[model samples]
Structures are given as structure tokens and as C-alpha cells.
Target chain A: MEATLGIEGGATKTTWVVLDAEGRVQATGRIGPGNVSLLREEELRALLAAIRTETGGQFHSIGAAFAGCHLAAQRERIAGLLRVFWPSAKRVVVAEDAHSAFAGAFGSGEGIVVIAGTGSNVRGYREGRWARAGGWGHILGDPGSAYDLAHIALQRVYDAFDATEGLVPLGESFLERTGQKDLEELFVYIHSDPSKDRIAALAPCVLESAAAGDRFAVDVVLSRCGLLADQVKCVAEKLRFDRPKVALVGGLFEHSEAYALLFEEQVRSRLAVSTVFVSRVPGAVGAARLADEAAEEHPGVEPKPSRILLRESATSLDGALTEERNPRSRFLDRKSVPELVELFLAEERLVEEALRERKEEIAAADRKSSYAVFCLKKK
Target chain B: MEATLGIEGGATKTTWVVLDAEGRVQATGRIGPGNVSLLREEELRALLAAIRTETGGQFHSIGAAFAGCHLAAQRERIAGLLRVFWPSAKRVVVAEDAHSAFAGAFGSGEGIVVIAGTGSNVRGYREGRWARAGGWGHILGDPGSAYDLAHIALQRVYDAFDATEGLVPLGESFLERTGQKDLEELFVYIHSDPSKDRIAALAPCVLESAAAGDRFAVDVVLSRCGLLADQVKCVAEKLRFDRPKVALVGGLFEHSEAYALLFEEQVRSRLAVSTVFVSRVPGAVGAARLADEAAEEHPGVEPKPSRILLRESATSLDGALTEERNPRSRFLDRKSVPELVELFLAEERLVEEALRERKEEIAAADRKSSYAVFCLKKK
Candidate 1:
């Protein structure tokens, strides 16, 4: 009667499934978004409580894959949250949405996974080493996402409104679909809402326009596909794989055969990947499979009690904020010589404190270290 | 008795020259950094006073080109500052540093100017139209600048420290030049100082290593030069030039002949340019030439009095701060149906007020419009 629980949590929705020892589905439930960064603590707790109510019975193991679980700290936080609801579960595994997608596509194997749903990211995993590129969200990169495709179409619309040339059929269709009377209203709608999903919704117009032979739209599609292919090539090079195996996931490829074919053709032309497959398996199933493996590895072992405690300090994610706030050393340029000297002294004191904290480790290493080893290390 | 004055002000230094009606140099003065954005009012006033002391003579016309004179408002502010120092001058012309560089290289003609001093920017001027790219400052862009080159070299050094592979000769050179024994000391030095100029000073090591045929260094140089060439191409495309005329400026080009040649080769390979020149003419001389042209055109006509007053209001720069402070519209996501409706109504009120302000202009345009024009416009 021992079973496993699996969950796939994303920006739009969350899905949970319970499976028996033989992998037969026992129960299933669907709920709202479960992205921890996007949800309040109370909302997350309530969602988990509802899931607990629906599942009804205890499980041998539980696994969850979530969006916004890219950082190690995020994974740890989600693991802590899960342990509260499933205290008796023998094993709990938490991972990024991409990792689950990859596992679902190719179980325990080496491959590249590209997810081009609302956003796009290309990740390659081979023999426990991973390489990734072009997942910098909407503002920074995201070259081949629905949002990117729609953004290109909108840029053309704006251009057509401003200039005499470069008009496309998609501009008219977009206006009609949105009930925007003119470019000015379209501008207002775009600026006022500023939502990624709302923007991505316009991607269909681009595809339709391209299918109907709009040159501008066709160019956008081709160029964006080329850019995605470049991302694949970049990942392959970084991973140094002899022949990459790639799996494509997400809504864009599933819905549009034309886009999928175009993307595949471009990628094949650029990279010598051995295989590329489009997977329809839900990431939740992959989570369940992973739980089964973990359970079999550590059979009948009790879960650790200390796993429930959350790590308090904010980690390396805050490094980006620090860099942003102080981009350059221009502040030092304005300070007088004396002030700069004082600042340097203060910084040196911090270094001294850090050294003091590591004094024991340093002394132990010094006692054990040899001159030959030090020279070898230097070389 | 009538002399024309010209000044070229940059991030590193400022140069001023006094010339007679026949373009003979009367007096010249050089001083420290003159970027108005980087200087306080009192500092700028003192610098101007020092310049006045050096060139102690009346001038009929004065033209000043300054860094940070990107916006029309910035130009106006610089002009106001100039008027305070030279009240009796017939005319005071203030422009961006790039414009002066262009004028210096190609007087009143169409050409692209690429500057790679402390920062990097590509500017194309054709007739009265101007197009620019890649001057997003140190944090965002500035891809081919000295700071950018140094930053790339520093990243490689850190990478080598962390991993066994990817070590290059430039890392040792950089460590030696910075007087840092290890990565920890380098980290402290970089964090404590944080100055663009200090970082940029390391660029010479990259160039030297590149010249010495270090594979990693060569790759960095080639890639960066290619990026700069891309910027040049982008500006040319935006300006829609048939055969671009280009001039290279800035300290990097002046000091590094090998780098200049490599950059030129890359740009020429990618773009069909009619002419490419590396000019040694100072920007101040260009400003002087511009003043000479202005004085000839206006003769003894007095400058407009209203031009002395600086614009007081801070405009769209505040918009960026607002966007950063409230990145998401999740505030709207949390509101109930009635609250959301109230928010929408409030937003509509603001829109209505904007429409009210522009009502007269809209009506004026409406009277001169036709159905055919409207449909054509819509199409």
C-alpha cells in the first residue's frame, strides 16, 4: 500500500499526482500557481493544505518540481516547505522545472532540453555536467520565447505606424483582436498593462501572419528560430559534447508544427546533435519517477527531523543586487585622498576579520601542506 | 580684436583654444576632467575660472563640446554654464563630445565616428540626422571600451583561479600589474576601489598579451573588436548610408596601432565603407573650426538673451526610477473586483486629463484630416 507523491508547480498552475508502489496512479489534483517567489507564504501554505486534504493518505516518498527554483537556496526553501506537509515521507526531492522536464524527456540519460513556453531556456546536461544559456527572463534575453516573438511583431507594428514602409498583415489582425482602434490605443494598452502573459498572447497573430505570407512576420520567425539555434549551438560548445541529444518541451512546439519544424531544421543545420525529440510527458510524472528511484535506493529509511528547518540568511542571489547598486568605483573618485585612505583601511579590517575566522583552517592546512605540493599547485 | 574660443570637455580632461578671425591659435589651456555629470557646480565653476585665468582675453564667439551632453536639456545647461563665464561673447554653441569629434574629422559632412576612450560609442551623422548606438555606460553596454576589455580579462583571471583549465598568460600579468598575490586580494582591491579608470588601466595587459599571441587574449581582442564593428554596422544600418564614411577617435585607437588596425580590418570586412580614417586632430580644434564657421555666418549679431536661462524641471529620467521602484503590477493582482474597478477608474481619470491637455491639438489635426487619409493611415 506504500505510494509516492509528485508535483509540478509553475507560474500559471500546479498539478499533483499520487502513485502506488507499482506506479499506478492513485489520485490527482490541480490547483493555482505554486511559484514560491510569486506566492505569499499564507497562499502557499493554504495550497499545500488543500493538496494534503485531496491526497488523504500518507506516502513513502514525495518529489516536487517548481518554476523559480533555479537557485540552490530556492530549492532548499521549497524542500523545507514540502517537509511540513509530508513529514512521514521517507524521501523528498525538489528540483527546477527544467530539470524535471529533462528527466521526463530522457530518464537518467544525457541530453539537451529546450523549453519554449511562456519563456524560453536552453539547458544541456551530460554525465552530471550542465550548461545553460539564454534564460535571462523577458527584459534581458529570452530570444525564442512566445513573449519574444510577440515583442518582435509589436515592434513591426510600431514601425509601420511611424514609417511609410514595412507594413504587415499581423498589425491589422492584432488591432482587430485587441479591439484597439489605432496605434495610439495599442500603445496605451501595451504600456498600461505591461504583463508578460498578455504580451505573449499576441504571438498567435505573428504565426498566423507568417503562415498567410506576410514577409515581415516570416522574417521575424526565421530570425528568431535562427537565434534559438544559436543558443543550442552555444550550449553544445560549452558542454563540449561530441554529439548532443536534445529534447524539446513546452507549449510553443506542441501547438505549432511549422515553428517546431523550422526550429529543428535551423538547429540541425547549425549543430550535429545525434537526436532531437519533442516530449509530451508532464513533468509531474518525471517527479514521481525520481521519487521511486530515491525510495528504492534508501528503502525503509526514516526522513531526517532537521530537514524542516529553513536556512535564514539570504545567499548569493543578493550578489546581483549589490552589483547593480554599485556598478562602478566612481564613488571613490569623488572622495578626498584622506577619505579614500580611511575607506581602504576599513576594507583591510574586514579582510583581517575574515582571515581571523579562517585562522584555524589555515593553520591546519599549513601543518599538513608540503613545499613540493605548494609548488605543484602554483605550476 | 575679435577672437573665437573653442573647448572640448571629456571624462578624462578638458582642452580650450582661442583663435583669431583667420583661425590662428591665440591662446590654449588644458585642465582635468570636465564631464559635467561627474562634477559638482562649485568644482565646475572653479575649473572655468582657471580656464579664464589662462586665456585672459575677450572672445566674439565660443563653442564648447562636452561629455554628458547627450540630451537637448544637457546641451542647454552647458550653454548656460558657458554664458556665465563669457557674458560678452556674440554666440555660445554647446554640443556633445561625439559631435565635436565628428566635426574635427569631417567638417559639416556625413560620416560615422567611433569613440573608444574611457567608454565606447558609435555615432553616425548624415545631413541633419544623427544615429547612435552602444553608449549605455559601463554597467549596461560599452562593449569595446578599455573598461570592457579589462573586465573580460579580469573575469578570465578569476575563472583560472577557480578551475584548473583555461589558464592564460594574461592572468599572471594582470596579477603582477595589480600587485595582488592571489584571487582573494584581487577581489578586495576590485571591490574596494571600483573605479572605471583604474579598471581600464588594465586593458594594456590584454593588448600586450594579445600581441604576444596568447590564444585566450587574442580571442578576447578579436571578439571585442568584432562587437565594436557590429556597433558600427548597427549605426550605419540605422542611418541607411549607401557607403559609410568612418573616422576612429579616442585614446585606445591613438595609442594602440595594432588594435586600431585589427578594428579597422574587422569593420571593413563586415561593412562596405567608402572611407575610413584615423585622425589625430584634437576635438578642441574642431570646436574652434565650428566657432569660426558660426562667427562668419552671424558676423556681429548678439546671442539671444533667453538662451542664458537653464531649464529647471527634471523630466523622463524620473520615469526609470519609478519603473525600478515598482517593477511589477502585482499590486493590481491583489485587489478585489471592486478595488480593481476603482483602480481602473483612477487610471482612466489620468488618461482623460492627458487627453484634455491635448484636446486642442487633436481638434486642429482633425479639421485637416480626411477618411481616405484615415484609412490609409490605419492600413
Candidate 2:
């Protein structure tokens, strides 16, 4: 039985599935995360090796979908890994996890995929055209992102600080999670961190509270869900996705059934979404399906990531941290040039610290490169 | 014939008034910007010199309130300049324009003063204590600020780009003001700018559109006014004020009667405000009035800005531009470390460019400092 291996990669969880040449389910497989950027090459290879060991089978072709695998270099790196494990395989396909999720929902068709994990994004496809909304980021506007909810919750806590001595339920959750006694320490803890994952990780805390019937938490969750739904509707409207077959992916949809229900309610209420599914099929299966199609079209000739069926991102995804609102410089628009300089100088410390933390790695690489140069000179 | 020189310095405009020993209106004086951060000492002196020529009289004291004049060092610098001009003055008082604005509105009494200039801030005083809301900054939450209005408009334009070919009224205003043909150029131009004044400068455009009944513009302005109004109410409730006397200040109130009315309406509808008035008397007059009270209490002794009637800010006011949301890094929370480093590196270019633009002045300062060291050594 000729089999095609398929994998769906995401930040929250990753899964794999296999399909026969006739597109029937073949074998179940297990793998680690599919988000390419989150793993080192060695780590990814080790995790991926589990599938080969578990199935003990040769694949005719392998299709892998991983989150953040957008750049050609990233796709090539992932493809190289696939080739290494399945050296005898005639064809391998590597693509974005979003594309795979879309395929999983509506195979070889068009629809919208909205993922509200730690972050949030909405992508719609119709008639070979793509329309995107949200995903600008937490600062610019993540809309329904976990970071966004956390920000509002934090802001609310700070606001309530002057109004009352007691902590609100949301604030209490933050304090309990952070193991801090007071709001001041909580404020410092949150502001001191360089990454948002710590803040975003509290989304479940908020959701759990909401599910437990906290008015504020419930309101925040519902409103945030609406904001996310608005993105889906906006994307659908742009792509003219009438009766859109929408696939909800990522943390918010999977972690809390209540949250998923609320989000679905928000979406169904706002937009005429048809076949709104929680995407039980992992992206790996979708990727395998896509791979099967690609193998049929190319007849075993090697195809670059660009040749994959799903649309390549046309928008500038150079998307960076510089676009983020620095919490320290929130009032910058009100500052004069001299004050602006002072603020910029303070921000420089953080950037320098970011580099300083990577000093040993940078130094080690420099030494290796220098020794390489010495060897070349000796040669 | 003893007199006091009072000046109110603001970003929008600076005004000055004179009062006699008996607190009656005296010979008026003319001066330039009262924003201490915006002017060099020489520039300020030259501008303050206008008052000297215009009034041509000595004074018993001088009370000048300048915007952004908060630091102890900043107050001392301004006081030094005042001493040079008012040689024999028994009293000199330098204060924040907000303090003066509050004083101007209620004299020695208590009330809330809300300023919605290029930036927005609300400060309320009751008894001996003070309460404040908003004015965190554009990124943090300036509430009803021009920057807030402008951000919404720009976001609207970007959202509309995928939906329609025609420019919305707000977009039209942005393009017309920037002298750009389409949204692409406008987007590029905005993203390229180092400062936010370019974006904030478009507030009037949004306001004008709102005034002319542009649906999006009207909804945005009204909603923003409500946000700002909420701040005023928050401050009032914190202090437990009944029939609070609220005074509206800043460019939004002064530039557009339509906007001022809308804001007042929002405030009135939300809270039981006994009175709401646009502050016609500039902050400088209020500073002078406070100076008069100080002279009476201390018997002609010079009081530091700290000793003045208004409460010193208890919160961390070491505000900076780093707190701002960098437009380029809008999606940073979603990025990985490698991508984050890339974003940070790109942001460094902007900071480097900022320093490069001032390189000539920096070099000159370095040369001067080196020469000073050489001269000291020779001595």
C-alpha cells in the first residue's frame, strides 16, 4: 500500500496522519510541534523521527505543514528534514500550517481559517484570492488575541486599584498565577518581561474565570471573541465568502470548550458562516491530502514550496517588533524632542540587554568563524 | 503699582496676563510658547523679552506655567531665566501648565480640568489631595487625544483599502494633507516618519470631517469624547465629588466649538456635572493667581515648584518614547526570538538615524567639551 505521510504543525499542538494512494486512511502517526521557528533543526528531526519508528513504513510522498514556515529558506529547511527521514520517497511537500488547516477544513477548496491562539489571525480564500485581517500584533491591533485580553485585564486592574483596596477576580487570577501578593509587584513583573508569552499564557486563566461566571471576565471574553469574529467577517466580506466554510484553529478554540462555544456563537451571530468546524482533522492530514494532489500533478518530480497548491503570502510579512508599542513610551506622542530622546535612550537599554543575553552564543560563533578563517589561511 | 507677570505656555498657543498688587488686571504682557521642553533658554529669553518690551515695567513677582515643565531641574532653569528678566522680584513661581489650567478654572477652589490638546490628560483636585486619569500617552491611553483620533482614522483607511477602491473622507483628508496620491504612499509616508506629530496633526482633519457629518468620523470622535469623559468621571468618582465643577481645556475645545460641545455633551450625559465651561483664561493667569496666594502666605519668599498649591504627581512620571507602540513591530507578540531580533535590529536603524541627524551638533559639542578640558589642564 503506497502511503502519503501528512503532518499539521501549530504552537499549541501538532499531529500527523497517513493516507493511502487512493486517499483512504492508512496509518496513525505521532509527532511533536509543527511550528518550524520554535524548534532547532536537530530537535525537529528527533521529534519527526517518532513517526518513522511508529509506522515502520516507507512513504511514497510526505506533506508537512508547519506554522511560521513562510520564508523560502524556512520551507527548504523543513523540506530537507522531510527528505532526510524519507530518503527514498519520490516527492515531499512543505507548506504553511494555515494552508494545511484550510485544506483540512475544505480540501482543495476555498474558505477562511481563523486562529486565535496566543496571538490571533484571520485569513480568507476565495476564487484563488486571499484576504487577511487582524494579526497586525498586540500593539498595532491583535484584536482578539490573548495578549489583547491580558492587556485589557491588566489595565482594568490598574484602574480599579485607585477605586478599591480589594483585587478584582481577574486581578486575583493574575496575582495567584504570578504568585504576587499586591498589584504593584504584579505590575512590575508584567512590565519587566521582554516577551508577551507570559502575559498571553494567562488567557486560559481569564477563560476559566469567565467559564466560572465572573461578569468582568465573561464580558471581556465575549467582546474579545466578537473582535476576533469581526476579523473573520471582515476577511469573508473582502473575499466575498458567502456562507463561508470557516475553520477555527489554535488555543482559544481547543483549550476551553466554553470559549470555543462562545466564539462560535459570536461568529454565527455576526456572519452567515456555513460549516463552522473546530477542525478535528489535524493540519498533517490536510498537508498529506495536499501532498497527494501535488504528487498526482507533478508525477514525482521535486517541487519547491512555491509550487504548492495553497497561495503564497503576497503581503509584506517582514512584520517585526519595531511596530510594537513599547509599554515605556506609551505617551510618546505627548513628549517633546528632548524628552523623546530620553525615552529612546531608555529603550536602547532593553535592546542592548536582548543582545547581551545572547553574548555567549554570539562569541562562540565568532570564535568558530575565526578558527574557520585560520584553517583556510593555513590551507 | 506693584504687578505680577503671568504666562501660560501650551503646545497650541501661549498667553500672558498681568495682575496688580491688589489682584486687579494690570498692563498685559506678551510672550511666546510656555512649553519649557519645546524652547531653548535663549529662544525662551528672546520670546519672554517680548513681554519686557511690551509691558516695560518691573514686577513684584512672576508666575509662569509652561507645558511639560515638571522636573525640579526644568523649574530651576526657568526660574533662573525669570530672575534675569525680573531682577528685583521678591517671588518667582514655575509650574506645570495643567496646574495653572486647574487654577485658572477654579482659582483657589477645587474642580476637574480636562485638556484635550495634541495629547489628552484629566486632573481633578478636591480638598488637599489630587486625582488623575488618562494622559498616559498615545500608546498607553491618551483617551480623547488628537493622536487617538488620528490612529483610528489611519487604521480605518487601511481596513478599507481591501474593501473599496474609493478613498473614504478620512482617507481623503489624510491623502490631501500628506499630498500623497493613494493609500500606498500614505501608508509608506506614515510608517517612515520618526515622530507621531505627523499623524497627530491629522486630528483636525478627522474633527472637521466629523463636524461635516462623516459617519465614521462622527462615530469615532463621539466615542473618543466618551472615553475622555469617562476619565473625568473616574477622577470625580475617586474624589467623591457631588455636582462637580468641570473645566474643559486644550486644542479640541478651543479649535472646534463643535468638538467642545460634543465633549461637554458626553460629560453631561454621563455624569451629574454642576458646571462645564471652556477655560477662556489661560494657564498663566492661574499661575499668577497661585503665585499671589504663595506671596501672601510666605511673605515674599521664593517657593519651589514643589511648595506650590497643586499636588505633585505621586505616580511614576519618568515617561518615555520607548512606551510607544512602534508601527513597524505591530505583530511582535506573534514573532519568535530570531524574528524578534530581526525586528529589533530594524528598529535600531530608526534610532541610529535619529542620532545621525544630530551628528553635526554632537560633534560640535564633543569638540567644545574637549577644548574645555584642555583649557582646564592649562590653568
Candidate 3:
């Protein structure tokens, strides 16, 4: 019997599932962030090979969604690597993980999926169209995300401190959670080696504080949720979703039932959002479905241009020039060829910095890959 | 004529003025941050020797205000270094640089000084008593500071981005100012090696954007100034100064005439402020006056306990374990002897981290000190 494999890579961990032709889960495997953008070509190859070994079976179809796989060129490159890893696979597809998230949220149905986990993004599908808001990242976007909640809360604490309202309950809770003795140590704990997931890890404290009537924390969460509601509204308006069904997916919503309810109330008030539900479908399952669809498609259809979606872990792209589009994408439409080339060159300069920042993760992955790759190649 | 020297050390640089007994400036010299807390014992001694060499003359009195000299023990340690540098000086005193700023702002008179530079503080004096608000540092306090302005502006930009308000004029200006091409690059520009002064440097962009009529930027500055106004009132109420004089000191006020005007408008509307003026008296000059006063004081009059004032650059204290008092100070009066010792030991672990961070500055000073100390010894 023919089978299909689907992979979903994230900042914290990478997971994949194998499905028999009948669409039943045949096997599952997990590993570190075998991510798209940060890995060198060889490392990526090693990761894919290891995945195949874990499945311990041949596949005729594959769909892989990795963070940092933004452009058609990137997707095609990943597809080529998969072909080499699983030579028997006749159909292969690779896309940015956001697609998998959307697939996970609503499958083939039309609705908006708000992914506000380690990073954040909002993507909607309706009538064969996709619209999105706030998938940019923590730096200039992703407001109302877990990172935003924690960051704004810190700002409020600092601002409150100026009014001689020093170290309110919210700030004190953060100090306790992080095992930070004082504000100075907390600052070091954050800025010294800031990570998106790591900072977002502190969001639960803000939620806990707000739940317990910490005024500042409440304000922080409410304001962020308001922004997030606006984000949903933007996608709703853009996609013209009449009474849109929304899936509030991420660690944040899962961490606190009160937080999820608060966010739902906000979005419901701001947007006539019809349905709000925490996502139950795993992104890897959506990838498997996508794999199934790809295998069944007629060979004549030109591969559709993958729509832009946010990576699972935007922090993986920190210091990384996250080039979403190549010269062909809409982002480069206004630029002259030379200007576009120059833009790419400027991004190239920052690539090494990103690689260096991710060196530890790469080294750790390399250690795991060595044994895994050797075993897979022998098979 | 008897001679006296005054030294004021900030995060960016240190300056000293040798004053004649009549309070005329005889000579002035400047160098890099001869900070207190970050410096090791030998490094502090070396820095003092360098200052003495630059003075090129013997002094009867010396008074120094250095960032990080918070505790009585730290002040005494600095005084001992100064004594070694100026062996013939009859009187030596040391204090935190905030005192120098307060002395600079009001001299011997009683008034409130609002310092909203890279970091911030509000200190008011009345009848030999001092009251302070908001000198805590950027992590927990120092709102209305330059760093706060820049940071808050960025947060607004991020929140706005969720609603498709990405890279507003204020954020664009920050990118232009930092020479970053995009938001992700700007994040790297900030978090890669976050520093208080470095982040504070972005404040002018927000100020400029506000001047240019960017609504968010305008709100950021206005709100921050309003906070600064409240801070002034806190100090004023605490010290019970009737229609007290307020000095708007620091780079924020110095950077823009309109900003200072806006701040004054807020404070005047909130409090029955008698006078608000930009400070012209440099902290070094205030330190010079303090030196002269020390030289003239009777031997029986104990050197007064140094009052807490905000540092000239609070960034120097970032990531540092800033201990403000030893067992003797009023701060520790309520604590048991055992608790005080335990607290000091807890701080010892952080001391090494601070030292590691300041190693480059120490090395830079050591090179300069070797030549300077040799010349001074020969004299």
C-alpha cells in the first residue's frame, strides 16, 4: 500500500506524521527544530533523511511545512531535498508552516485562523482567497501575541515604577516565575539573550496576574486582545467573511481558560466574529491531508503559487532577514531589478549574523543528525 | 590660595574641574566613564590617578560623584581611592552622581530637579531633607526618560501593526535613524546587544516624529511628559516645597525647545510650580562647589551622608546588581544584621557578571592610567 508523509517544523520542536493511502495515521516522529531558514543545505538534508528513517517505510507522497520556507524558490528547494530523501515519493510539496496551521485550523473549509503561540499570525481563507494581518513578527508587529502581552506588561511595570508604583503584582509574578530576584536581574534575563518563545513563556504570569485583579496586567492583556481583535477584523473585512468562524490557536489560549475567554469576548465585541474555538486539529494532520491531495491531483496542473503565511516560530527568524518574496512576489513588484538585487544583497549581509545566533541549535541538531543520518542511509 | 577639585562621572564620560578657594574654575579635564560600581578596586584607583595627573596640581580638597557609588562603603572606597590620588588633600568626599546633578540644578537652594535623559529621576530638597521619585532604572522605572520614549514608541508601532498600521512615521524614522532597512533589522539593531544609552539614542526620532505631527509619536511624548509632571509633583508634595522651583535637566529637554515647553506646560497645569528652567549648571561645576565647601567645613562637622539622586546615565547600572546601602544606612536600619550579610553575599554573585561586562572599559582605562599615573608619581 502507498503512503504519504507530512512534516511540521516549529521553533520549539519538529513533528511529523505518516498516513497510509486510506488516510489513517501509520506512524509519528518528533525532533528538535529541523527548521527551514536557519539550517544549511546539508543539515536540512540530514534532518529529512532522519525523518524518513523514523517512519521506517517508503512513501509515494510527501508534504512538508517548515518555518522560513517563504518563497517559491525556497519551497522548490525544499521539495528537491525531499525528492532526494525519499526517492520513491512521486509527489512532493513544501510550504511555509503557516499554511499547515491554516490547514490545521479549518482543513479545506473557509475561516480565519489566529495563531498566537510562540510567535503570532492571522490568516484567513474564503471563496479561494487568502488574507492575513499581523504575521510580521514581534519587532514591528504581532501585537496581542503572547510576546506582546509580556512585553507591554513589563512596560507598564516600568512606567508604574516611575509613579512610585514599584513592582506591582504583575511584575512581581514575572520575577517569581523567572526566578529573578529583582528588576535588574529580570532585565538581564530578558535582554541578554532574548528569544521569542522564551519571552512568550512569561505570558502565563501576565494572564495569572490579570485573573487575580492585577490592574496593570489586565490593561496589558485587554489592550493586546483589542489589537488582536482588530487584526481579526482586518482579515474578516479583507476576505469579506460573513460571520466568520475563528480559531484561536496557540499556547497562550491553551494556557489559561480565562485568557481564551477574554480574547473571545474582545474579538466578539469588536468583530461580529461568529464562532471562536480553540483549534483541535494538529498542523501535522493538515500537512498529511495536503500530501494526500497532492498525490491525487492530475499531473497537468501547474504547481500553484503558495500563499504567504507566518512561520511557527518567528523567533527563528530574529536577526534573520526574513525575505518572504523573491523578485517574483508582490513585495518586489515596485522595485527595479538592480534595486531588488541590492535589497537581497543587503539581506545577505545579515544572514551570517542570524546563523551565528542559531549556532547552538545547529550544533545540537548536528549531534542528533549524525547517528540518525547514518542509520537512515544504511536502510 | 587653597585649591579644591570636583569630579562628576557619567556613563558616557567623566569630567572634573579644579576650583580655586574663591570658586573660580582653575582647570578642567575630561575622560571616559570613571564609574563607581562597575569598576574593580584597582581599576578605580587607576582612574583616580589618571584624573590627578590631568589636574597637574595638588589640592586641599576633593569631592567626586560617580555612578554606582550608592552605599556608604562604596562611597568610602571611592574616597580612599581619591585620597591615594591626592595624597596631600586634607578633605575628601564621594557621592552618587545624582547628588552632583541635584547640586548642579539648584546649588544650595531647595527645589525639585527633573532629570529625563537616557534614564530618569526626580529629586527635591527642602531644609536639608531630600525626597526622590523614579530613579529605579529602565527595567522597573525611569518612565518619562529618553529610553522610555523610544521603547514606548516601538510598542505602539507593534500594536498598531496588528491593525495594519505597520511602520508608522515614528517607526520609520527610527529605522532611518538606526540605518536599518526593515522592522526585523531594527529588532536586531536593538536586542542583539541591548544597552540603555544605545536604546535611548533612538529617542530623538520619536521626538522628531512628534514634531512632524505623527499622532502616535505625539501621544508618546505627551504622555511621558505628563508622567514627568506627576513625578515632579510627587517630589514637591513629599518635600513640601511651596510653589517650588523645578529644573528640567538632562538631554531630553536639551534636545528640543518644544519638548521642554511641552513638559513645562504639563507640570504647570498639574502643580502650582513657581519656576521651571533648563539647567545650565553642569554637574562637574556642582561637584567643584562641593569640593570647595568640603575644604572650608570645620573639622568637627562630619561629612554629611550622601543623598540618593538619579545617575547622569542610568544605563551604566543596567544588568548590574546595584546595592544602595550597607549595614549603617537608613535603608538597612530595619533589617537584621544576618539579613544584611546574606543580602551582601547574594549580590556578590552578580558582581562578577558586572565586572565581566565592564572589562573592556577597564582595559581602556588601564592603558591611559599607566602613563598618567607615572607622570603624577614623578611630580
**Candidate 3 lDDT over residue span B264-339, tens digit each:** 6678778896666666346675665455454333222223322221121221212111111122233333554234
Give the per-residue Cα lDDT of candidate 1 at A110: 66
Name the regions of candidate 2 deviating beyond 4 angstroms.
A1-107, A117-119, A135-141, A158-167, A172-213, A237-243, A249-261, A271-379, B1-97, B126-131, B157-166, B179-181, B184-198, B234-243, B271-274, B280-379
Cα lDDT listed for each candidate: 0.63, 0.63, 0.64
Task: Please identify which of the two predictions, 2 or 3, would achieve the higher lDDT against the true structure.
Answer: 3
TM-score of chain A of 3: 0.75
| Model 3 per-residue lDDT at B116 | 77
- Quality of model 3 by C-alpha lDDT: 0.64
Query: Against the true structure, what is each candidate's TM-score?
Result: 0.47, 0.53, 0.66
Error of 2 at A377 (Å): 70
B1-379: candidate 2 lDDT, tens digit per residue: 4687787777656667666665545544444455666677788888778777776657877777777664566777777877777777777787777777677666666778898877888888887667877654453466678888887767676666544635787888888988987765564466445244777888888888876767777777878888889888888988899988787776687566557656766787788976665554445557776566554332223332223322211000101111222343235435543343233323444545544554454335323433432332233
Where model 1 places Cα greater than 4 Å from the true spot, the runs are A1-110, A115-121, A126-262, A270-379, B12-57, B68-77, B102-114, B118-205, B215-248, B263-281, B295-379
Per-residue lDDT of B304 in model 2: 25
> Model 3 off-target regions past 4 Å?
A1-9, A18-27, A33-97, A139-141, A155-201, A213-219, A280-379, B1-6, B33-96, B155-199, B213-216, B286-379
